[model samples]
Target: MEEDFVLMKGNEALAEAAIRAGADGYFGYPITPQSEVMEYLTAAKPWERTGMVVLQAESEVSAINMLYGGAGAGKRVMTSSSSPGISLMQEGISYIAGAELPVVVANVVRGGPGLGTIQPSQSDYFQATKGGGHGDYHLLVLAPSSVQEMADFMPLAFDLAFKYRNPVMILSDGAIGQMMEKVKFQPQRPRMKDEELPGWATTGKTPDRERNIITSLDLDPYRQERFNRKLIEKYQKMKEEEVRFETFQCEDAEYLFVAYGTSSRICQKSVQLAREKGIKAGLFRPITLFPFPEKQVGALADQVKGMLSVEMSAGQMVEDVRLATNGKVPVEHYGRMGGVIPTPDEIVEVLIQKFIGG
Candidate 1:
């Protein structure tokens, strides 16, 4: 039998779901909206009873380094923060990607330029999906629009991170992180083993067989080029295997809505309202930002008259949408910033103006 559903905030659900997924360690600093996740984990006794190692680091820099250490030790580890904290962790994140360690990071994004605001915002879209730190690497970025999705995506993030030997990120926002909604917990799979650790792990073995060295430094240009090629190969595979999206009433729609994370939730309501008004509006919600559902969106563009990219930022995913549509459809943007959110009614008006050419 399935478990009963209960209301939960996105951040709270994330913490609980990660614990259920058998994450062995967590390291993070306090940040608005996302801070509750750390609070929940600290209070839940997941560390004391399950032998999980939960630590509140002094800063985001220290927190991410802690994740690097835990992942290098072959332990399932995670961390959560908002935009500024995430910014601080970029160095560690890049290192994790280069070393091919599996670690999960959650960013309940707020507005940004520098010290933007505590309220909800989708401003981190580009940063999360486009290799925020340095190098030509991509993080598996999952955008959860609802609290329920927050719970559902946690284990998936972990699985993908380990499978790809790369960092994975849950890119939500303050709205989803702070808002309460119902969620049904799924039956979790058996706990994973540290044995899943690749041969690259430093197990401190005898000197006879071979010593494993985990470093991104390849002084030889040819070797460095080879490493880059291998990384690109994995990214190619990810593009094929990991793209995920949710479509609503898109089959015969005249207007398409492109949105993700908290912005997409409002888009859902807007689509419903448009239907009530006899306007053919549909929503294309990208669940994975990096392994973007570009092909699917391109297919939809062939049928739709136009597309609207909605976000809390000025325009980030808008660029990706344009790339996906390939200049086939008239793509427009509607958004708010500095922690303000676009309402369903506002989105409908934009649809009216853009689609109807009003």
Candidate 2:
């Protein structure tokens, strides 16, 4: 198949990918660092080409609920928002997860405790991975480090969502969302017809089949308990089979760097800088943050002397790395919150000071 390539902003790639991936609808409110997604979609006018629906919702809460409705109908749907906006959508996000709907969401993160700065940060790690919404639910989180991944993850996220009957999140940051890169867009796939919708879809009454109901509400405690158990089983299965991560210079390294998304890219550079200084530093980049590369990170703990989990947050993911390592090695966290990005040189210095000097 011929690949179509384009140089575009990461956010634009995301919108283009959704259209090319045959997404049925996108409903979202404008939020900085991620507003380009909706703007690109609106400018492209995908409805004219692929019959996709793009609506600008009044708020993030409304956007997420709109996505839920489209997803329940078995249509590919998605939304994008930045930090505070995502916070508003939490309740609706939980609802979608509870209903076991297949949809994709992109979070282009910014600094936050309240209405924080528009600059980049990875502070949302805890929110994205630790079931940000509510209950015993999880969104399959994908962390993309490049513009290429911004384009590529859209289709993959949709596929995974439908496979597990769950929602998926592309946890991007302002750095990647605004950066421009050359992306090789995948070949287009035709949209699914209403008749071709999956068996579980609530596509309205059909003469030959029983009515399909789509919802997350179960007033009965026992019935809801059963559903919760099913969701737990689904998450376990995903952890066992769908964990995705990347390793660099790990075959023979004494120290390790664990990160994801923008932080991972910076850590990759830090590893190189550390290696130049006669330090054996490897990088572990987790692609799937929820189904975290725990087992793999645990395995590395046995080989490395110490590790540092880098991020743009006040160290959210470092806790996960500590959990993954399980006290086998000394683990430390290094980062700047409020949208400050750390430098590779600074990261290597921290590694040396915290581990070797200490």
lDDT of 1 by residue, 194-214 (tens): 576667677777667587776
Give the distance in Å from residue 282's predicted Cα in candidate 2 to where it truly belongs: 0.6
RMSD of 2: 1.5
Badly placed stretches (over 4 Å) of model 2 are: 1-4
Off by over 4 Å in 1: 1-3, 188-196
Top TM-score model: 2
Worst 10 residues of 1 by lDDT: 188-197
The worst-scoring run of ten residues by lDDT in candidate 2 lies at 1-10
Tell me the tens digit of each residue's lDDT in model 2 across 5-66: 67899999999999999999999999899999999999999999999999999889999999
lDDT, model 1, position 113: 84
